[model samples]
Target: MPASAPLPKSARRPRPATDYDVVIIGAGSAGLSAALVLGRCLRRVLVCDGGAPRNEPSPAVWGFFTRDGVQPSELLRLGLEQLAAYPSVEVCSLRATEITASDQCFTIVADTEASRTRSITARKVLLATGVEDELPPLDGMREFWGHGVLHCPYCHGWEVRDRALAVYGRGKGVTGLALLVSRWSKNVVVCTDGPGGLTNKARQRLQKQGIAVREEPIERLEGTEKQGLQHVLFKNGDKLVREALFVHPHQHQHTNLAEQLGCRLNSKGAVWTDKKQQTSVPGLYAAGDTTAGMQQAILAAAEGSLAAIMINEKITKEECV
Candidate 1:
């Protein structure tokens, strides 16, 4: 057979499918951190986000060393702008719909504005897709959340210190949250909302600590729009006015992309990953609230950086081989 030259321009390798070195889903704290690291390493990266952050309802983000009280949106905007300096990193404001692996690379389909669908291929995938807090079905709870009714003491306890605080016994988190919030307020009330699994010993401990345990089922949250939460109304027509309220919301992973990719999940439904943030599925990794039980911005960012470094190293090694 005669030797044949390459085909015309239209019959090439299709430009290798525009495979990126890494594709990070969710541009929140974790995703942004990972992108920053990978960009600094001069890696080809793409970050797809829906712009709906987990803490969007929260007025301010706490516990970040120098950025305490920073608005979540402000922080994200600054982070996005900073990442803009890296020419290799691209940030697309889109929602990732599906991810599938093809040989050694992965393809990600995202839903952008105007309902347009876009796809990108990447050698590795980092899922920083955070979790969502399923709030209680109490009236006015959503309006006061992150203002006076809050979840994390580490995030909002200081502001309400020494005030009359109420904790809702919704799940296994009530006891722990009550104890922790006790440090912030001398007058703390734990509303069991009727019978719970708490033992007598636990009740005694709470009483000894000057924490009041109310067994009445809560009816609704009473508060004003401007002043935030004011009190809790009980089914018995009684009300206990409070300066602040604490409740651990039932949280669930916002996306099942990790599970769909065969990544192991923890007992809490969070994506299970190793120290390097690598999930069970090779080339697939997860970090931040997707894997962490204690969802904090700083911790998520740290995990993101760790995952980025691991990903960069893996890509470097593979390229060398």
Candidate 2:
């Protein structure tokens, strides 16, 4: 038995059996949506959620229709509740550790909360496992992440629109993102954290817009999680006052399951998928943030729906043959 107590009987959902038609490796918007479609199609589907959502820190998930401004945890709860109506679907709060394929079947080994491991076999697999953002290692950065510090402007831009915004990061991507952040806030500064590696053309363009460029390395972020970001301190003993900071973090898949299964990765490190959301490996599929760079709940759900549809079609055609 695990050291922690199990969920109350009322809170526990039935677990899926050993063999399944499909095993979805994430329970976020994309995985849950895919599971719903596959379940309604009468396919035996299991959704394994590791219980860690990238958007958990965000106050609300934006840009999603009907559920706009909804809390990420609440949105996931509602999705899980809706999925309960489908008898063919089951959810396991476990993390997939390994995946192996052989002779038209795939075996998934996952670490369970019950202090034991479980293995299940499925005919097909969906890699909805999203990416983890690699934010810069700066004091107080993690404390204010997703609140005062954010990535997607469309998702969190409206709330901080017109606020004193600063772009904080390095590399060429930061230059473009800083320019983009200018749209949400007229008063913007680009804190390159030293040199910024920006081309002369980019610097001239930013200068034309009257955006202050601070090329000093950030020493620390001064603020409490409650008070939000106050200043970006520099090694030169100067500080830039800002309300929010935008970053374009380099992200990687949350797990190595895709790589273990031999799925090809694109240049940006996201899982490469075709128009149908099928990965390079046959019988394997991917969706959501893992498949593209533009990370949004609605877009991920749409990709999940598309992946489910294609998977259903693929399975049906296979059966017919």
lDDT of 1 by residue, 52-135 (tens): 788888999999978999999998988999998999999888788888886678988889988999888999999999998898
Query: After best superposition, candidate 2 residue 46: deviation in angstroms?
Result: 0.4
RMSD of 1: 5.4
Evaluated at residue 285, the lDDT of candidate 1 is 88
Which tens-of-lDDT digit does each residue in 68-157 have in candidate 2?
899999999999999999999999888999999876778999999996899999988999999999988888788889998988899988
Model 2 worst lDDT run, 10 consecutive residues: 9-18
Residue 16's lDDT in candidate 1: 46
What number of backbone clashes does candidate 1 have, counting pairs of residues 3 or more apart or in separate chains? 0
Q: What TM-score goes with each of the models?
A: 0.93, 0.92
List the RMSD of every prediction in angstroms.
5.4, 10.3
Runs of candidate 1 with Cα error greater than 4 angstroms are 1-18, 170-172
